[model samples]
Structure formats: structure tokens, C-alpha cells
Target: MAMQGLLPFLAMVIVQLGYTGMNTTSKLAMDYSNMKPLVLVAYRQIFATFVMIPFAYFLERKTRPKITMSVLFQIFLCSVTGITGNQVLFFVGLQKSSLTIATALTNILPAVTFLLAVISRQESVGIKRITGQAKVIGTLLCVGGAMFLTFYNGPIINIGESKIHWKYASNSGDHSSHHQSNSVLGSLIVIASTISWAVWYIIQAKVSDQFPAPYTSTLLMCFMGSIQCAVIGVCVNHHKSDWSLNSPIRLVASLYAGIVCTALAVFLTSWTIQRKGALYVSIFSPLLLILVAIVGWAILHEKIYVGTIVGSVLIVMGLYAVLWGKDKETKMKTEGISVVMPLEMVEGSKDLELQLPKDSGSNKELIANVEENGTIKSNEDEEKNLGLS
Candidate 1:
């Protein structure tokens, strides 16, 4: 039980590490190139598709998606939200605001996901359950923490420069180009990106459900993303005479974002979520703010103001609250339930077998309810067999 519980948390940690590295690297890319946000995002997706295509083929060629016209459309829709909108909005927001704040706001994914799930009738809010209450309260706390991190700022404790220094901040300071106090527009854009991301997760859940193949779904999404981003990149480069390897930083950023953040982190997540659950994979995002803060102060010479500290605490507490609620909910539903990792979705699980607890009378009734509803409505009961390993 102990090891089972730890698995999901561990997955989030791994994902966060890669994500923090990507954030730092992307910032560096902006420093090195005069490339626009669209251009960077376009190239990033192209590389991401290139990287994932061959891997998906080699790893999953036997069960790979058949590439039907309908599946192709799904891939296109996925590319729009998951790849194109998410990266474009995010980099643009980062361009206007601070990465720490961007990370803070983005950590609200679980809450946003929960909210949207409830609205879409994909999940129910068990008001009487302590776990449910905890989840709701935790989500609110996370949001509050994010707001605090962004809006409150008194003292700017100077954290020294990166190994690679940038005169950009100084030049911008002289020009007064960076002040957005929870600036409504910037916040909205980030929120939009978050919504787009939530959409990605929900859709991924469906696609994964249909194909029961995480790698295949990812491959399709990336393949379409490559085409979409390439078109945009060509458009962005139309004005330029020399598009061949202009900026090493852009190339580096695109690779790291594509291969490391998108490809590797994604596979880790699919595996972890299979081992644990989506909620588990999601909660670790808040922690990345701390990682990014450390990186920013150490490498980028960013200021660590009091507000960032306060916000971090709030976010942490709220995240735990949500997790507490989810834990209770899972415990109640655990009898006869098991966390089944679809073998095709994740590797290293083909030989693993779950030992589900014997079903109580209530559990039997619950199963009956699920079957009755299964034929009627499809929703977020991802499986009765989803929990700690």
C-alpha cells in the first residue's frame, strides 16, 4: 500500500523536473533569439512531432493508430488545443509576465479540471464526503495561492544572475516594459491556456479510452501538430531571407521543449497516471513553481519577493487539501476496485497485476450502477479499477 501510494506522487515529481528544465531553457531561448512567440512555438511543435513519430512507430508499430480520416480529424482538433494553443498562449504570457507567476497560475490545472469535469457532468461533487469537501476547499486554496503569488509584492530580495547573464531586464527596466499587476489581460490569457490544457486532458482521456493506447494517441497528436506548426513557422519566416539555422538558442529551446518536455514528460505522465490517476499526475505541478523560483533566482537573477513566498505556501496547502479529498474518495471506492494500467498505454506494466480487495455489498451495488449507466452516459468514472498501485 505504501509503495502503491507513492507511485503517483513520484510520477508528478518526475514531470515537474522536466517541466522546470523546459521553462529555464525556453527563457534562455528568448534571450538568444529575436524570434517571435509564434515562430518558437511553431518550430517547437515541428520538432516535437519529428521526435515522437519515429519513436511511436518503433515502439508501437503493431498497434499504432490506423490513421483513418476520422482519427485524422481528432488529431487535428487535439493539435489545436493541446499543442498549438497551449504553447502559443503560454510563451506569449511568459513574454508579457514572469515565469514564476505563469507557473503559479498554471498550477491551477487540477482545480480547473475538476471544475470543468463537474460542469460537463463527467464527475460528481460528493458534498457530504470529507474527501469531496477537501477537494473543493483545496482547489480554492490553490487558486488563492496563485493569486497571492501574482498580485502581492513588497520587497524584492535580489537573487543573483544566471551563469548566462542577460542585459534585457536592465534595458527593459530603463524603458518600463514590464508591469502587469494580475493584469487582467495577461491573467485571462493564462487562464485561456489553462482551459485549453484542461480540454487536452479530457480529450486525451477519451482518445486513450477509445484506442486504449497512450502512445498512439500521442503520436497522432504530434503528427498533426508538426504539420500545423510547420505551416505557421513558414508563415512567420516568410519575411526572413535566411531560415536555415539562424539561432542556436531557438533550436536548443525547440528540442528541449519538444523532446524532453513534450515527449519524455508525456510518456512519464501516461505511465504514472496509469499507475495512479490523472489527479495524482496533476497535483505535482504546484511544486514546479518552487523549482522554477529557485532556478530563476539562481540562474536568471529574478527577485524573490514576499508575495511569492506567501503564494507558494497557500498553493501547497491547497494542493494537499485537494489530494486529501481525493484520497478519501478513492478509499471509499476501493473495495473491488483496482488500478489497472492498460499495457499498451504504458510499458513496465505488462507483467504487473493488481490485487483488488474483495467487494462489499455496497461495492456490488456500485458496480451495478456503473453498468446500468455505462450503456446510458459516458463520463469520468475512468474505471472502477483506478487507484494506487
Candidate 2:
């Protein structure tokens, strides 16, 4: 039972690690190999489809639900928001910004999703409740953190130098203004991706309700996303030669992203959601930020700023608050249901007993009849004793 409970956590941890690896490889492909974001997205989806279709086919053959038109429509919508839009924006943003910033910005996802849920009337802001208040405050903190992270770049914290110095430094140095503008743009784009992802969650919930087959849904999303991205890629990049996987880094990035990040990550996430829930999965996102920060510092030799650290702290705190609130709210609701159900059952039993017909007319009349019978027996006993004497 303990291990069963821990399985979801372990799965999510693995997923986050996979995501970290994807970020590293993707950054290398885009920055060093000069792979276009659209082309990367296209390749990612194609690879994911190829890898995931087999699992969806063989594993879910017996139990897979029939995909109706409505299900397909939902899947298409999911593909648009979750796959094509989310990944396209994310890759573009990643190219523009540092890995740490990209990862940190994603911590706002839970807050955004919560706000969306409230707006859509799927969730409530029980302001009178502490949990609800926590959620509201947490959302604000996350938003504030994101804004702070975008605009401010305080003094850089100089960590000890990384031993792995594998970089061709640009000769054209010190373009501070250019980098700043790019960072702002990238942050905004990444934030948009988070919103798209949150929207996907909402739509995917509906899909899960209708379809319930994670692997099949993922395969469909990947397939559709590949087609969508391919069209976009072709129009944007005129150079046919650019699409060639001549570079090892590009090949590795596409393969890793498609197989591990898209197919495996999605499956693991869906499985965790089945065992735990969406909120539970979302809470684990902060782990990615931590992983990215460490990896960026050590491997990429990225500099961390004071503002970045502070903003990241705020985002992490906010993410936890939102998750805690949601978890608390769910538990309270479950407890309330358990409490109300038994009370309702007891009240129903009492009402049933009250409505039952009685054998006796009344308690007072029954007692009086018993007393008169006892008096008659006593008189008979007295007469019998006198005759014997």
C-alpha cells in the first residue's frame, strides 16, 4: 500500500527528469545546431506518433474506447492547444531565453489553471474558506513572480566556474539591450504557452471523460500535431536543405523530445493523473525549475541573478500554496460527503421506524389492562386459600 501510494510520485519525478533532459537537448539543437523551432516541433510530433502508435494499438486493443466524432473533435482541439501551440511557443521562447527562466516561468501553470477553472465555473472561490483564500493569494504571487522575473535582472550571483567549458563564445559581445528585449519577449511567449497548456488540461479533462484511453488520445494528438506543425514548418522555412538531420545534436534532440518527452512523458502524466489527479501532477512542476536551475548552472554555465532567485522562490511558494489549497478543498469535500451520507441514512431509518404500524393500540391502555388482570388473579388466589384453611 505504501509503495502503491508512492508510485505516482516516483512516476512524476521521472517525468520531470525526462523533461529536464529534453530542455537541455532542445536548447543545444536550437542554439548550437541552429534548428528552426517549427521544424523541431514538427519532427517531435512525427517521432512521438511513430513511437506511441504501437503502444496505443497493442496495449489498449482490448479496452480502448471507440473514438466518436465528438471525441476526435476534442482530440483535435487538444492537439492544437497542448501539442502544436504549446510546443511551438515553448521552443521559440526557449530559444530566446535561458533555460532557467523558461523552466521558472512554467511554475505559474497551476495558478493559471486554477484561475481558468474558477472562471469556467468548473471550480469555485470559496473566499470564506481558508483553502480558497490560499489559492487566490497563491495565484497573485505566481503572477507577480512572473512579472518580476521578466523585468528585473539584479546583480548576478557568481557560483564557482563550471569545469565543462564547451562553448564557442560569440565575438560580438555585450548586447545587453538586445538580450533584455529577447528575454522579455520570450517570457511573454512562454507564459502564453502555459495558458495554452492549462486550456489543454480543461479540454483534456473532457476528453478523458469521453475517451478514457490515455495512449490512444496521446497518439491521436501527436498525429494531428505532426500534420499541423508540418504545414506550418513548410510555409515558414523555404529551405528544404534546412530540414535535413545532418547534425547529430538535431537528430538526438528530435528523437529524445518525441520518444521521451512527448510519448513517455504524456503516458506517465496520464497514468499519474489516473492514480492521483491533475492538481497532483501540476504541483510537481516546481521540481523541474529546480532541476533546470542546477543543470543550467553546471552544464550550460548560465548565470543566476538575485531577481531571478527571488522570483523563482515566489513562484515555487505560490505553486505550493495553490496545490495545498486544492488538495485541502478536495479532502474536505470528500469528508463532508462521508459525514452527510451516514446522517442521511440514519434519518431515513428513523423516519421508516416512525411510519411502521404498531401491534398495540396505546401504551396507557395496555398498562391499565395488565393491572386489572393482575387484580382478578389476586382475588381468585385469596378465595382458594380461605377454602383450604
Against the reference, the lDDT scores of all candidates come to 0.57, 0.67
Q: How far out, in Å, is residue 40 in model 1?
A: 1.5
lDDT accuracy of residue 199 in candidate 1: 69
In lDDT terms, which candidate is top? 2
Distance from true location, Cα of 154 in model 2, Å: 0.8
lDDT of 2: 0.67
Worst 10 residues of 2 by lDDT: 340-349
* Candidate 1: residue pairs that collide: 131-325, 162-299, 338-385
Q: What does the lDDT read for residue 204 in candidate 1?
A: 53
